[model samples]
Target: MDTTNSPSSTDTDDEPRWKIVGPGLLVAATGVGAADLIATLIAGSRYGYTLLWCAILGCIMKIVLVEGAGRWTLATGHTIFEGWSSLGRWTHWYFGPYIVIWGFVYGSAAMAGTGLALAALLGGLSVAWWGILSALLGLTLVWFGHYGLFEKVITAMVALMFVSMVTAAAIAVPNVPDLLRGLVPTIPDGSVVYLLSVAGGVGGTITVAAYGYWLREKGWNTPRFMRVMRIDNRMAYVITGIFVSATLIVGAELFHAADIAVSTGDQGMVDVAEVLRDRYGDIYGTLFLVGFWAAAMSSLLGVWHGVSLMFADFATELRGLPGDHPDAQAGGRYFRAYLLWLTFPPITIIFWGEPVWLILAYGVLGAVFMPFMAVTLLWLLNTSRVPDRWRNRWWTNVALALIALAFAALAVTEIQKAVSGVL
Candidate 1:
């Protein structure tokens, strides 16, 4: 006798569209971080509204890239690592070294970045101490909390960031005409690198690659969730665009209009917060710092959970274990190991600066990853690997191809910048 319906059918029917937007929102908020904000601020200060179009393009490019990643996972029950494995042994060859080296460098940078924001907010502690504290706190939270709790914390932080940035932008009262004019694509003289950086780098990073694993965590393994996943991805990036644009607006109105120069890196954000305080008094500046800390913390928490899942899966595959092995799930041994790797070793960078060779390697590898991801997605999605209905449409192919080309150019530029800096 057939029951009302199978358990799977019942599960599908009960899942609402809105509930599934979690993974996308998590990825978008995590992707922005302090670096993306710094990039946007620099762009706004240098070119005003002239390069605004590039930021929007960046958002679209990320949507296409992330969508491709999510679609592959839902259409195939295999994890993304498994799909990469299907490509060849070369895939593992690239990812193995890349993750290890990149994680070592990035973990430190992320911690220092978060620490800088916290130190700015607190006003008395040294940046290094605050950064060390942040790393330990992030470790404790991720180590003990399950995915559901982690997701909730990230969502709350995202809300804090959005409110802070949007409110700051509103208070700045950007020139309506210039804001509208920025929508037109135009490049100022000697601004090509800034243009390319903004166009290709907005909210796009290794976190985009983490999308598939996040989907698995959210239980969107079946093909039925594909449409919902697409909707979620698109909406998240749209929100990302708004958040980014608000920062740009703040930069244009606050720094550009006053002919002020902010410093480089994450510290520039602190400088801007100080300027805001000096100009608008303590409350406005405090709000901006709060937003800055939220953004940094979101990135920290995200990489802690998301990349740990990725490393655990990689370790499982390397050991010839099944994908569903419990060790690959949250709080598993391998996951905790990577989470610790992301937390503790990086603290040493606070006392001793990053090595020259390490920075060069991080730059070269980081540059190539997006193009690698784009080209691979094009290969995986077009072949017999995915179901016919799930295959990328013609327009999707064009978007991804452009994304690959753009990223390749950006990668070359980044490598050049790294080499030049070393020289």
Candidate 2:
């Protein structure tokens, strides 16, 4: 029986909706790392509520993108890669190099991100060592395909992050009027990059592409669960918006109002934690650091698991395994290999800084990926690959086109930034 359209035993018809945290939440939370928070914080510190609207728009963009991914999975029992493969050889050409390169470089960045937080929180080890430890810990947790346990741990961590960051925002008492004005969407002087970052960075990156794999992991495999999935995606990104906005509020109060400047990158996050301590006392700073660590750790764990599933599936497909093959899912041979790829070799990048060529490759390839995903989704959802009834609506098409255009613009800036950083 094709249960795609039926609310069968596996569809959670008996479970209360409120208790079910869908796969969307996992993917959404995974994308909000230390870097994203600092981006929004710097924007707020520099321009007050000026970029708040960008945060909101970024969430909506992700919601649309993720929904398209999930819908493709349920409507067809095929994964995103399978759909990409159907599009033509070009997808294979693009995705093959992109995923391999993206994973190699991203693994390094993810570790450093988490390491910075831990070093800030504990103070016993250097960032590089803490980053290595973070990888080993992550590997141990997901080495054997403990999906249920992994999901639970992520949920707990997300809760920790939400409580701490939101509480800090509350302490800062965000200005009601300024926040309202931000919704009007006017550009301030020299705020283009900040505007684009906030608009494009929130709620996603390659992890957004992992949404379908996450759906399979959560057992929401068919169209009967699509309604629930949309609800979950919407709720998750909305909270993501608030979570990001709260950080901006904190930055506005702590740095902008006080006229203090913030440094760049993840270290900026550490620096702010100290400022948080100086202003709000030891306990508050400690709590905020925990939140920062949770954000970094959650992102690390997510890519480790979710992207591994994605890579494993791609590998399995290459060897002609069935779509439902065990090897294509978590704990498979390829899955473990990719997990190692995400864990071990990148430790060297932590010890030694990223090479300039690697940065440029990472930047250019990484920049193009967002547009690749958007344009591809627009293609897949509109084509005969999807059931006619399940195709993209006009609004969805318009939204994705705008998303593609927006990401393309950002891609130019990212490539230039990468190039200039090296030069």
Candidate 3:
């Protein structure tokens, strides 16, 4: 993109070396929680190695999505929210309520997910209490800590998740020949839903847009850091691919081989832990639970920090405050307000589970977001809103278009399923 508008280039030009990892890792780790892991495992267990290409495709598409977000920030010196605001007043109308509602539902879901992992580890506590504890812990960390501390803690959790999941994959003894065959992209019969779900759901989410905000938090606010951001984005998703693929291997080796069906929802991961315990030993089972908790908690931490930034920024703009205002950034009043919104009210869901109507609404809202992200990002990166050099190239447009189509289809299906469930 155009480096001229990048305010930080003058200061960062002499910096010695670029870090291989950054906010990208946090974004990737946070996006793939227990539900994602379980989804990948379910795909593997049901279809063996048939859906490996789908997961890889998901990672590639996310790289494009995140790169677009980071590019906008670096080239134009605006957050993604600001870019959306530039589009029209309607952007505000859409996002203002969307963030509020999405946060309320997602908070409980995220906490309950982490709680499931914690309950698996500490049977003395019920899942509801564990979920509440997880939400409180995430709230405490984000409310008290700044970006540096948040980034470091998320990095540590990513390490724990990587090591444990990969080790478990290795123990599963994947069939090399079958894995190689999966790369060729053959969909087994009756696997259309699983195929779309894996391809579209792997690594893309609301958090992909958070990449830019996280980059700002990491002191990479200029085009000079563009190369580093790309490397960071790719590396993070590469690790995501490895982590996801390993879970698939676990599913293939354990559930597929044994012809066992995993449970549904967050508890499914707990079932996997039990499977690990029975097939391997207690230590392996405990290790899997640790990894599960890392994935869940990292997601809780990531959204608590990242989306809160988005929310705070939205609130600031809504109030006509400057983007750089303290209240719009980390550990500020607006930020903490959104953080609490994401941590507390959802606890009710933990105790009673999501009400039927609320669950349906959340499903409908969640279904549309990825497609919204893909479409908006495609628009944002293509126009003069971004620097000419950073505009979406032909390949980038192609990828995003495909992502939009894929996610739109998935959204339709999800909405149908949600409605059907309610009826």
Candidate 4:
């Protein structure tokens, strides 16, 4: 199996095993943050096995979006940021401010989530200290570890999360009949929040844009790698789909039976763990908590690495510099600057509460990003920029259009909730 993403490969007899798995795993793992888990768990608990179809749909949408990202990279030999830039300066105009602001706000939140999960698993430290430590650890690893090293770490963490979480689900022994019923794909009454969450939040974010950067790092630079890239992206999301489905199954079987009410936010996973402990035992609950920590940490590391690369590219391009120029690649001035922005400035938010207005802005920016990425890819891939063979198929365009609309609707509701203090 050749791990090289270049078009020079000629080996015809290899197994093509692990080489097929690329940065798609990192993207899928990064996208399935703590928030996604809680959403799935809540969906299952509130309406047992009813909305499983949303999770499946979410996976399909991700595959389409990610493949678009990878296709643009391989076809054009340009990053997604560069592809977006081909449209005009306005693409950078929107991305520049959004990346900086999003990083500052999300950095604190992600580190804090990782810390909370670690605090639950390890007994002595407060969440604040744990969060600070987690942030530093992520910074250290990515600061030294380039793309390959970063991919290995995220893959291992995601694997640990899959094992423990799925094991817990297996122990729960969900009813096959009810699980099958979830395939019908209907939204139940009063399940608006759950529906939006499962449909919109299943393994998605601005990090999807990072797919190109990771492909670049993986050395997938030409059209011949297209088949391998597609396989990698599909396999990664399928694994993500399984992990999410297992979470839903556990939620339906365990919490639905007990009538457990899950709260909103990352802490909801902890709440579920407690319920599991009461019914099953400490070992089961502890194992699940460990899995939860792995998920949170994987997300934290991925954002720390991927978004820093994005911000670095954004800053360099704003200065009219090239990507391979000295200051745009890993550990360069722009990259480290964004790294500091992601790791340090956000600590202030940890001390002083996150400002309501800034939080609102974060929600607004985040809401727009998915649609922005999808719509931009639709434009980039459809034009003469890519060869006809690499251009989106009819079904691909339809899927992307639906994804854009779905994300737009979700964004509107998010803004409304932020305005109403309901999010």
Where in model 1 is the C-alpha error above 4 Å?
Answer: 1-18
Using TM-score as the measure, the top candidate is 2
lDDT of 3 by residue, 1-423 (tens): 221233444443455434558798989998998888888889989989889998998888888788888888988889999888888898887788778888998898887888888888987888878888888888888888888899899999999999989989898899999999888888899888888777766664778878889999998887777877776888898999999999889888889888999887988888888888888899998998999999999999999999999999999988888889998888889999999899888877766667788878777877888888889988988888877877887877888898899889999988998899888
lDDT of 1 by residue, 1-423 (tens): 110111334443466766666899989988888988988898888778788888999998998888888888988888878888889989898898888878888888888788898888886888888877887888999999877888899888988899989988888898889999999988889988988888776775788888889888887888777766777888888888999999898888888888888678998899888888998899988998999999998988898889889999999998989899999888899999998888888777778887889889888988999999999999998889988877877887888899999999999999999989877
- Lowest lDDT block of 10, candidate 2: 1-10
Q: Per-residue alpha-carbon lDDT of model 2 for 173-274, expressed as tens digits?
A: 788898899888789999999998888889768899898998898888878887777777888888788899898888888888889898888987877788
Error of 2 at 44 (Å): 0.8
- Please give the clash total of every predicted structure, in order: 0, 0, 0, 1
lDDT of 4 by residue, 347-400 (tens): 999898888878887888888899998899889989999877678777778888
TM-score of every candidate relative to the true structure = 0.95, 0.96, 0.94, 0.95
In model 4, the clashing pairs are 5-220
Worst 10 residues of 3 by lDDT: 1-10
For model 3 the TM-score comes to 0.94
Q: What is model 3's C-alpha RMSD?
A: 2.8
- Of 3 and 4, the candidate ranking higher by TM-score: 4
